[model samples]
Target: MDLMIANQKSLRNLTVLIIGAGPAGLSAAIQLERYGIDYIIIEKNKAGGLLLNAEKVVNYPGFPHGVKGTELAKLFTSQVQIRKIIKDEVIKTGYREKYFETRTKLSNYKSEYLIIASGTNPRNTNVIINKSAEKKVYYDVINLSHHKGKTFAISGSGDAAFDYALTLSKYNKVIIYNRADKIKCLKKLYDRALQDNNIKYVKNISVLKAFASGNGLALTLSNNNRIVVSYFVIAAGREPALDFINSDKELENLIKSNRLCIIGDVVNGIYRQVSIAAGQGIKAAMEIYYQLNKENN
Candidate 1:
C-alpha cells in the first residue's frame, strides 16, 4: 500500500483517537469505554497532565473534604485503565477524505474522529534566577515535600499560587507575591490563605532579582527589601499545550471537516478546572457518538 494508505491501515478499526491523558482526555476515554467504542489515547508525558503539579484540588466534584491533585489524577487514571494508552507525542496532524491522521514521535495513528485534549503548560516568568538555585526553584509544587518547614516565596497571585500556599502551609511558611494590587485567585483561596498564619500575601511587589546562597535563595523586591527562602515556586499562569501541523490550511481543513474537536485548556481560556475539563470531554465524546450513529444509519 501507499504511504497514506499504510498510515491509515496501521490505525485501522479504531473508532476514535484521543490525544493527551489529562482529566479531559481520560474523561473522554471513560465515556468511550462505557459505549464500548474502540479508541486510543496518546500522551507525550505522564498520564496526569498538568494536574500532577497541583498541590491540592478543592473544587473538583465528589470530594467534599477536598483531595490532592495527585490523588485526583490517580482516581481518573484508574477509571481509564481498560482503554489503550500510548505513551508518545503527536508531532503533527492532517486530514484525509473521511479520517484524520496524526504523526507521533514513534508512530502514526488515524481515526474517524479526533479529540484534542492536550491541555496547557506552565507559563515561564522569564525571571533570571541564580543558576545555582535551579534545584530550589520550581514551577509546580511536586515532590518538594521533603523541604517542609522551610520558607517558600511563590510568585503570582493566581489559584495555583494560593493552592500551593495551602499545601505548603501544612509544614512550611509561604509568602505569595503579586505584582499588582488586585488579586486574581478565587475569594475562597484568598480567604483561606488569610486564615492560615503560615501563609502571607504581599501585593504591589515585584521581584527585582534573585540570588542563591549557601542556605537558600534571596529575593530582592522592587521596594529593595530582601527576603530569603528555601525555595521559589512560580505559578504565574499557563499557555496552551498544542502540537504543530504542517500549515494553517491543513489545521483549518481538519477543523472545518467537523471531525476534529479541541477541548480542555488547549482551547485557551481563563478558567482551568478539572471538573470543567472533564465535562467538556464527555460532551465531545457524546457528540462524536451521535455523529457516528447518524453516519452508520
Candidate 2:
C-alpha cells in the first residue's frame, strides 16, 4: 500500500526519522504531527505490523464488543498521514556527525533523532529443514481455515497458542503443548481451552523430535509419547527483528548517547499490546521533542 500521511508538510529538512509504521511508530507520528515536527517514517511493509494477523482484539480499550485487528489498524493509520516515507527495508543505521544515517535497499537517509519500533518476527525451529516437512509446520493461524479436516498440534501455552487452538478446534482437533504445567496466558483463555472437547492440552512436556509421516508429521514428546498430526504450529515465542542494523558498535553508541529510542515490541519486556506500544510511541516523541527543543534554545 502507498504511504499517505494526511495534512503533511515538507520533509526536506526533517529532524526525526521513525523506522517501522506499526502501532508504536504511527502513534509517535500522530503525536509529532500535533507538535508540528517535521519527520518521516520508513516502513518495510504495511502499517499494521503484527496486529494485522490477530484474529480478534478484545483487550484493547474503547471497543466494548471487541474489534477486529485489521479494523483497529485502519483506525490507527487514519489518524496521521506522514510528510514523507521510504518504503524500503533499512539495511544499516549508524551515527554520522550530528545525525543518524540510515541505509536502505534503495537509498540513504539521515535524521537528527531516530526512533526504532520495528517490532518482531516469528521464532524458528529446525523441524522443517527436511523437504518432507515443508508444509507441516506453521507459525501463525492465518491459514488454519484451510486445514479444517486435519488435526494439528500447537507448541505453546500463551495467549497466541491457546487462541489459535480454540479457533482451530471449531473445525479440527487441536492439541496444545506446553513445557510446564503452569500457563502464561490469560485465565479466560486457559479455562476455555480446557473446556473445549476438540482441544486437548498436553503439559509438562516438550517436542523432542519430529519427522514427516504420510500426509502429516509425527512428533515425539519429552515424555516419550508420540503424536502424529497433519500440521505443527510453533507459537513458542518471537524474537526482535533487527537484522537491518549491521554493527553492534553503532547500536551501542546510540544507546550510550541517548540518540536511539526503541519503542514497541522490539524492546525487551514481559508483555506486548497495541495500546502499550502506542503509549510508548507518544512517550518517545515527547522525549525527542524536549531534547531537540533544549538544544535549539
Candidate 3:
C-alpha cells in the first residue's frame, strides 16, 4: 500500500524501469541497488503477485517448515529496501531511439533498459455469466477466507482450484467443480481435500453459467444441473499479462536487441516458481548493469 506518484524529472533519471514488485521485480531492484544503479520499480498493487495466493510455500528454499503466502511476501518486500518505487501502473510502454519509454497514469519515464516482470493474470472461462451475479464472481480467494458458514463454488481442475477449496473449507462449504475427468492438481491436495468433509470435488462437470439466486448465484452446470453458492471462484489457469504494451515490430526488435527484457512469470509458462523468478531477476539486473558500464567506457 505504498502507492505514490512520481514527478516527471525523477522518472527521467532512471537507467532501468521495472514494471512489477513481485519476487522477480524485488530481486531485480535489490541487485540493482547493490550495483549502484539508478532504477525505479513500479507496481499498481501490493508486491506479491500470484505468490500472495499460495496457501503454503513448501518448495521455496530456507523455509524447512513451509511459510504462508503473505508471510513470504513480507520477507521478499522487506529485503528489497527499494531505492525508487513508483506506486502506479504502467499504461503504455515501447522502445524508440535507443531508449525505452514508459507512461503511467501519473508520470512518464525514459530509461536505457526496461524489465517487465508484470506476471500473469487469471485465465477466464468461456462460461457466460449473468450481470446480476457477476459481482459475486472472483478469480482468487486471497482475502475471502474469513467468511464463515457460507457455500463457495470453485471452478477448475488445477492446483489453484483445490487450493482455493482447502482455504475456504476452513470456515465454509467448498465444492470444486472440474469439467475434466482427471484433476490436474497433485494427489496430495486432492487427498487432503477428500479427507475434509467440508470440501467436495465434483469431476466431469463445469459451471456453464450463473444467474442471481436469492442472495447468491444459481450456477448452471454443463450437465444441466443447478446449484447455489454464495460466490463463484475461478482458478482455471493463467496466461501472460502484457495487454498494457502495444505489440509491434519495434517492440519485437527491442526484445531482440536485449534493451527490453520480459522475464519471470510473464514468460515462464508452467515453470513459475519463486526461485526461478528471483534468479532471472538478478541475472537481468546484472546484464543491464554490465551493458551500461560498457557504454560509459
Candidate 4:
C-alpha cells in the first residue's frame, strides 16, 4: 500500500500504534475507532496470525456451525475495513523521548503510544530429522480433516495436546507421546481421552529423530523403539514473540508498569484462543484511551 512517512510533528495528532493485526490487534483497533482516537495497525504477515491456520473454530461466538479459521480472519479484516483504519507492519521500532518511531520495510511512522500485541510463536522440538519429515510436523492442529484416516502422532502433555488428539481422533488413528509418565492436561479432558478407542497414549516416550518413509513418517523413539505415522503434530507450547522489542528498557518497563498489559503468551487470563486474543485487544485499546485521557486532564 502507501508507504509515505509524514513529518514527525504530524504524529502529534495520532494516539496509538498497534503492532500485529491478529485478533487482539484488530479488537483494539475496533475499540479505538469507537473512541474516535487516531491509531493504526501493523502486521508482519497477513492479519490473522496463527488463527488463519486453524481448520475450524467452534468455540468462537455467533457461529453455531463453526467457521473455518481463514474465513473468520476474513470477517475480522472486513470489520477493520468498514472502520477505515490505517494498517501496516512494523519492521523496526525505536523509542525517542516520549514517542515511539516505527519503521516498516517501506515506510516510517511515529506514535505517542504503542500497543504490542505481537502474540506468541509456536514452540518446536529440537530433534533433527529429514527435511520432508520435518515438514509434516505441525505446531497447530486446527485443521486435521486434511489428514483423515491417517496415522498421526502428537507430542505434548498439556490441554492443547489432548485437544488436538481428541479432535484428530474423529478422523484419524491418533497417538500421543509425552516425555513424562503422567498426563498434565485438564482432568476432565484427560479422562475423556482415556475413553477414546482410536487414541493411543504413550508416556515417557521421547522422539529422538524422524524420517520420511514412503507416504508417511518413521520416528525413532528415545527408548530405541520406532513408530511409523502419516504425520507428526508438535503441541509442545509457545513463547511470546517479543524478542524484537524486549531489548528496549523503556518499552519493557511500559509493559511491566501496566499490570494488565502483557507482551506475549504469559499475559494473565489470556489463552491460545482467538476470542481471548480479541478480548485482550479491546482491553489494551481501552487502557490506552484511559491513560491518554488521564494525562490530558
lDDT of the candidates, in the order given: 0.82, 0.79, 0.85, 0.74
Scored against the true structure, residue 151 in model 4 reaches a CA lDDT of 92
lDDT of 2 by residue, 1-297 (tens): 012222223223348889998899999998988898888888887777777757578978899887877789888888878445568788777665566667667766667888999998788754433567767777877656556788999889788898888768878999988988989889988898899999989899877666798878988888878889988888978988787665466667676555778889998466689989999999888888888788889
Model 1, residue 117: displacement in angstroms?
0.7
Show model 1 residue runs off by greater than 4 Å. Answer: 1-13, 53-58, 246-253
Q: Mind giving the per-residue lDDT tens digits that candidate 1 earns over 1-297?
A: 012545445654467899889999999999988888889999977788878877778788789988888899899999996448889888777677677777778877768888989987778776678778787888777666556679999999888889888888889999999999999888988998999999999999977667798788988898879888998888888888774544466566566655777888888588778889999889888878887788899
Write model 4 residue lDDT over 56-158, tens digit each, in one string. Answer: 6878999999897779988887777533344455566666666677677656767777777787777757666788787787777654555678999888898
Best model number under lDDT: 3
Estimated TM-score for each candidate: 0.84, 0.78, 0.91, 0.76
Better of 2 and 4 by TM-score: 2
TM-score, predicted candidate 3 vs. hidden true structure = 0.91
Order the candidate numbers by TM-score, best to worst: 3, 1, 2, 4
Report the Cα lDDT for residue 80, model 4: 76
User: What does candidate 2 score on TM?
Assistant: 0.78
Q: Which candidate would rank higher by lDDT, 1 or 2?
A: 1
> What would the per-residue lDDT of candidate 3 be over residues 1-297, giving only the tens digit for each residue?
012224546556468899998889888988988998878899887777777878788889999998988799888888776447668988877665566778888888888889999998888779888999888998988768779999999999888998888888888999999998998888988898999999988999999998899998999999998999999999989999898787777777777766777889999998888999999999999888877878899
Model 3: lDDT to the true structure: 0.85
